[model samples]
Target: MDLDLKGSKVAVTGGSRGIGKSIATLFAAEGCDVSICARGPETIEKTRAEIESHGVKSFGTALQGRDGEAVRTWTRDTCDAFGGLDVLVCSLSAGGGTNDERYWYRSFEIDLMSATRAVEEAYPHLKSSENAAILVVSSMAAAETFVSPMAYNSMKAALITWSKQLAEQFAPKGIRVNCLEPGPTMFPGSNWEMIKVARSRTYSGVLRQQPTRRMAEAEEIARSAVFLCSPAARWVTGATLRVDGGYTKGVQF
Candidate 1:
């Protein structure tokens, strides 16, 4: 199935590793020019090289995701470098954290605000493209309670609402907006990987819930995400698609 994604320009936040990097890599494999941003310069360069190895143009930047100005600047730079933006994948997140006020603020900024800011900054370029789309990378944790209450889950919930609203507002402008909720995806250096080592009980409990007895791979989630953001899903918008491998129990009527 042709995604009709060749030559499309895409930007992914937190693309240096984990799910974000997988998304960027998949887009590149589809012949899309990819740009990514993350906090680690080394990983940024490494991922950039890997993306380019697929024979597509790749750009990357190392910056703090919570810095609104930096994020906006990176978005602009990517748009300029790529000639325009076709897809914007907001995949950066601060991960789960306890009840500390600081943790809430961190999650709010990194998980929620980064998506908001990237969409705001990329709006103009998106509005100009014939196949503009936005994929907000949320989590199944937003729909179902997993571990103890944490700001990551709530922030992701907020993104689902925001994406729907943005979709409605932008549909007429030809920009499709959608949200993807992944459940317990595991990849190298991912939070789940750390949890598997540091909190075996929690990791095992989550695994037990899945009929597969395993978490989704980064590539698996990325494939679903790219399809939603591709021209193949041109008519799909204002929707929250759960790519959780049945991890979420709620029935969406």
Candidate 2:
């Protein structure tokens, strides 16, 4: 029952809103000092306040994920503020779209490079912790063909692979690595909320495939995420857990 996450220091990227923010706040609820970075200063401050309300220390920075140096700086600042880092959750994303060439660059920089840069920067700090874990927020879209060809799916797929490899490499050093694939998640101001109105047919089509005929809330997915990277799931590593509420049909081997 106890996740044993108290007193841990956590860093979450793209955590100002949606699932990222949910994960950060949940960590704070579990007694972890949490730091988050995102593009919106206002939302970052609001989320920071929310995290601190849980009676844990909170820090936040506003930065675009495409900026590698900014990502690295946030990681360093978070470690400096918290004394050490125990959990790293890469939950920021560029989102999904296929309208133009710019989407490719956006997904690569935000979805892929941000996670890579954060992990690289946090490796040493993680190694020093008694309970170090990393959870990369990949999407179930990466596992199956949902929409048309887009950079978002492929970049997320790369995260799953990289997380597995990192797990094998980090386990020797006492740091665990894992990935989570959330099915279509909807929240106030989420992209799925936009699609529910803008692309009604597409939204309904996806929902019909779900046995529950519903999507997950950010807090719902955050529950699974927090557990995976918490001290409770210490033995879990190099695994990809899909928290899609049976939306995905393909069985994992």
Candidate 1 residue lDDT tens string, 183-230: 898988888889999999999999998988989999999999999999
Report clashes for each candidate as comma-separated counts.
0, 0
- Weakest lDDT window of 10 consecutive positions for candidate 2: 92-101
lDDT of the candidates, in the order given: 0.94, 0.94
- Tens-digit lDDT track for model 2 on 96-215? 989478999999999999999999999999999999999999999999998788999999999999999999999999999999999999988898899999999999999999899999
RMSD of each: 0.7, 0.8
Candidate 2 yields a Cα-based lDDT of: 0.94
Off by over 4 Å in 2: none
